[model samples]
Target: MAATPHPAHRFLTMKAAGVTLAALVIILFAGLRFVHLEADFPPGVSGSGDLYTDEGAYSSAAVRWVTTGQWRLEGDFNPAVNLPVYPLIQAVTFKALGLSLGHARLTSVILYLLLMAAVWALARRWAGPVTALIALLVMAVNFNAFAFSRLALLEVPMTLFVVLGLLAAARGGATGTVLAAAAFLLALLTKTAAGFALPVILLVLLWRPEPLTRRLAQAGLFCALTGLGLLAYYFVLVRGHLPDYQTYFMTNVLLRTQGGLWDLGRALVRIIWYGRQFDPVLYPLALLGAAGVLVVGGKLRRHPLFWISVVWIAAYLATLATQNYAPARFYLVLAAPVGLLLGLMIEHLARSGRRGAAGLLAGVVILALAVSGGRAVDYLRHPQYSWASMMRELHGLVRQDGRENPVILGHFANSLSLGTGLLSLNDHYTWKSSLPARLERYRPDYYVTLGGIEAPIRSVLERYGTVEPVRTWDVFHNYYTGEPVALYRLTRKSPLEASRP
Candidate 1:
């Protein structure tokens, strides 16, 4: 009924609207994270998947710090396990929001939203609004990233610092490089495993278009800052406890698994198999984006972001291949680069300026995003925190012995002890040499095991053999491996002799 507007006016209006939507997308996603911050453990059913063990361990440690003013896992000061940054964050959140893990989990949501914002900002600079939106959607909608990002764990927070460091590196100046170096240090301090990322980060200067002397100067200062920071952190400040951190680091994170080339192949295959199970589109698209980066960039040195994407993926896969225990969570950090690659590819495709082709690509991307959003919605509707019935049964059994509290031993000894008001020993952290002696001394009446080497405990308690409890918890700790919970009752042979059987 009205006169048509000019084509240029319409195009400009549409462009402005698109940019507004892109900006709002990330902010809306961040708001969504705060929703259902307290949702979990719908009664009488299984969880979406395995609970990363560190989630509870860190939360429990924070709870201990808040309640008793001790930042410890059980009674030990295992520095590798107690990397000060994330647990400190958890402690701060718990102090503000009260002692429940629900409050602690809010920290992850907040950090993850911040992570998305950082990713969006970086991607927008490298590509444009369309690419940035794609990056945001892929990161938020992908199953693995969505799942772990919401939980209270080191992975998301560590990943955030790593990306922040990269974003700083992209700023392209001496001062920016220094800030980037410092951010990488923060990432390392957050999680020692972040050490694997150092070499790739160090190569940031190679991406710069500076003169040889200038780039060299920047790289030298960058390396000096990062290296000195690590030395100061490990040797200077916590010098007295270096041995404890070293032992835990070597035993648990570094040498926890050993394998050769074939193992590496298997690790890659395992990663692909399980990674697709979470979101079929994300991994495949990321691989395509990586290839697109190389082909389009022509020379590696010219495209800093593109080169960085390739190096990041290659380095991460190499690190994963080296580890025999290929937990899916180990693959989580790749999400950052994957999002970048996706953004780059989407930007590249759009540059073709073919509306039909762009429409096709957009359709495919939208479909993939829709699928992930549906899965996320389904998960939120039935959030899986912990087994509710298992707690009731365990509590009932614990109360059966009216006279005294029964000693409990398990991999989750800290949480179990906190929940049951009993002395508990964490089987995973106890040194093998002292294990038998501790078992002999503690003589725990019941062993509440959550998947550890039970042979030693069984050998030690041969005289008082274990009777399997009524309930066996059906749960997965990692990648379809059913590390079920078992609460076995051990009674001394002399004490319960039933009719000379």
Candidate 2:
């Protein structure tokens, strides 16, 4: 016969066990991040390719800061692409620890660790310690989150700040409104996605009519402070080199809303479908969870936080749906709310004695973990996996050429350009407006072009120099070949005497 333990003893032991499990999961996640820290220039495959163009731009800006003590946001004389906050953060990292890819990636690792803490806090508030542990584990093994966190990108910081904002807002205490406002401002400055969260927060405050006036006042003060900070930072520190707000706002914000209803519908459908790419096994369960949230209408409607999260997810999805180009990555903000709903469903099922459903849910999560974890491990072990290899090869070529003053001209070439530390002329996919003159001015020692754009590059190079085959690299797997697809590079040299000098 087994001895029965006291209720208090069992409770204490379970709590200790949960803490230990959470610690182990966090440690494992950190270990995975550190293990792949220096295997490549940008730390991960997606981080080294076109997927991380923004990261590459920031990296180049950081490099300039390190070498010249200048923090100019303009890249290749294109001021429109500048986003100063992230680049400034990267510059500080580079300054603190010399200009190395690993150092740049470390900034992301730090942010990811902080994000885990934020997620843990949020989950604990809503679902207790066990579910929080599960949520952290899910985040740790989530392929998209893991991949992005290891890159020098703005998304991780933005996600972290957003989680902070949500955690602060959900506190349900006297300081909750103030803390939430501060966190929201931080998130807004980090990324434009933060703006979409405003409606949800406001709606939640309205639902909670008791603290309506107080919360609104706090939110107003926070927004004002944030605006003042932005104005001061731009006019005073940046010396009035404020970006073309109208153009950026119109193009990236207002004009982007021109997409038709059908276009938005298609994008939403694709987003919902593709969001489950990494975890197909859990797809049905996630849908069920979403349905469950709707089914528990009365309970959810009364809960301000629950409605806030739902509204945030819906508004974000709508915003993404309206975008001209929709990628699975755009729905990342949807993950947090999805996770919350999934956690709620799991708890509901567990409480209802539907142990089989809970087991099934756990199995799906485990399957997702296995598949994503395997992919991550493979990526870590094989840095030369597709686009990553091409970028690495290009970087090596530039380093070997011993040409510190080299310039490159191409379309969609920011990643390779920045990785190789070469001056980029332009990233336009189409040839236009004095292309020859632009090439001559940059006076590039090498002009590289990807395969798809080879014809245009050949025509452009004919006027300046001869095109030569430098190297080839594979891009994701191809269906026919049953292997990764290959991209060819064509390089050219300057023809003019002034360019040669």
Candidate 3:
């Protein structure tokens, strides 16, 4: 019989193995993330209508901040509708380097990788190296995470900060509390949704088995300092520049919660279901992991961090589910914890003499990574991937038509058109109603249309001038589909202006 390996040697071997596995996962994730860093915006921004609006607004703000030192919300840049942290960061980045949409998006990608590292570290602490590696692998290729990571939006940063906050809280160090507090404040500034799970974190700290008085006092001080700092920052620097923050808070937060508890339950279900968009393969494993948590809830009850994760996931799902609309992106916060739970399940299986479990987990992760990677590649190569490019081409058409300044009128198209530096005659006006009158009033030098023509666009274009055929662009979601996207220039004879001419 072979001599039994020493326990020390066995531990060393396992550690080495874990390191190797984690490195491999990181390499795989990086290749996928950076594959087309300079390409257009990610998939959702292309074909999906509403998704691009936010990205367009944020990118415009970034450009404004870089070109002019003003951070105030411009007509095209809707600060009132969005949280400031991510855009603020983008502005800072733009200030540091010239504005590059690709560079700005690359910043988000880097944050996502940092977030992955954090997840791996946190999971490693709770589970083991193998479980941590597996968890990172699962999150690396999760479609929603991958997609958002590539976009220049607040969601990815907010998700990163939330994960950082949770990781710090789990470590239970004094410095960790400070890190957690800072991250929490940043998340709140990034998105209103940050507030939903915050209370649960406070509750966890208050109820932890540690000295209740000390923990409560620490928590209170953290909140107080954070609140005071934010107050000072806003009042001194960003107060008047921001729209009525209180009004926004009331509408987005308080009023949003007026629905009954049953609404909350339904919302929770929807959030749970939305995870299917990320990866169908991992959903069953995640469910099994959630069941494991439920089965071991009694043991986990003593673990404050565990309860915090549970509460955070629960509260987030509940709040988002109750909302009138549930998008797949809203479920991003669930990715880390769900990945952790799945990692724990895999670990349990591996320990139970099920060697095949590890192989199966690896196989699923590899397959998902390949699928997500392929999707990312397709998005980059497709022309419609870049909203910036579409806007640029549209601007060129207007310029070529000798329309020095055109009154741009449209909805979703306006976002890209205005965002990429096109001049709009009136910010408040869109060609949604009475297009002919509005077109006559504004006397747009050109009319731009996108996402197929509606009556308003067609009527205005026909009334004003000839619609010149532009170019076609491809749009992307999970995959690429070519669509005829045209930018038409409508020219009209100026009455008084031409008389003067």
lDDT of 3 at 99: 61
Order of quality (lDDT): 1, 3, 2
User: Taking the tens digit of each residue's C-alpha lDDT, what string does model 2 give over 1-501?
Assistant: 989999879967965985696568657866798776645432323312345345555455566666656544242433223355566677788778876666777898898788878877777765656566666666676676667667676667777777776766655344766666666666666667667777765564345445677766655655565577656656754455434344344544676673678877888876666656434655446666666767766443344445655677677766666665544445455556655555555655666678688768866776776687777777777764445566677777766777656666564344454344455555442225447676655656555444444466557666566655566554543322333322333344534532663
Q: Look at candidate 2 and tell me the lDDT of residue 428.
A: 49
How much is the lDDT of residue 14 in candidate 1?
80
Among all candidates shown, the one with the greatest lDDT: 1
lDDT of 3 at 458: 70
Q: What are the lDDT scores of the predictions, listed in order?
A: 0.64, 0.59, 0.61
- What residue pairs clash in candidate 2, if any at all? none
Better of 1 and 2 by lDDT: 1
Q: Write the per-residue lDDT of candidate 3 for residues 183-246, one digit (tens) a residue.
A: 8888877876777657765764566458877787768866876788678767764566454355
Q: What TM-score would you give candidate 2 relative to the actual structure? A: 0.79
**Candidate 1, poorest ten consecutive residues by summed lDDT:** 41-50
Kindly indicate the candidate among 1 and 3 with the higher lDDT.
1
lDDT of 2: 0.59
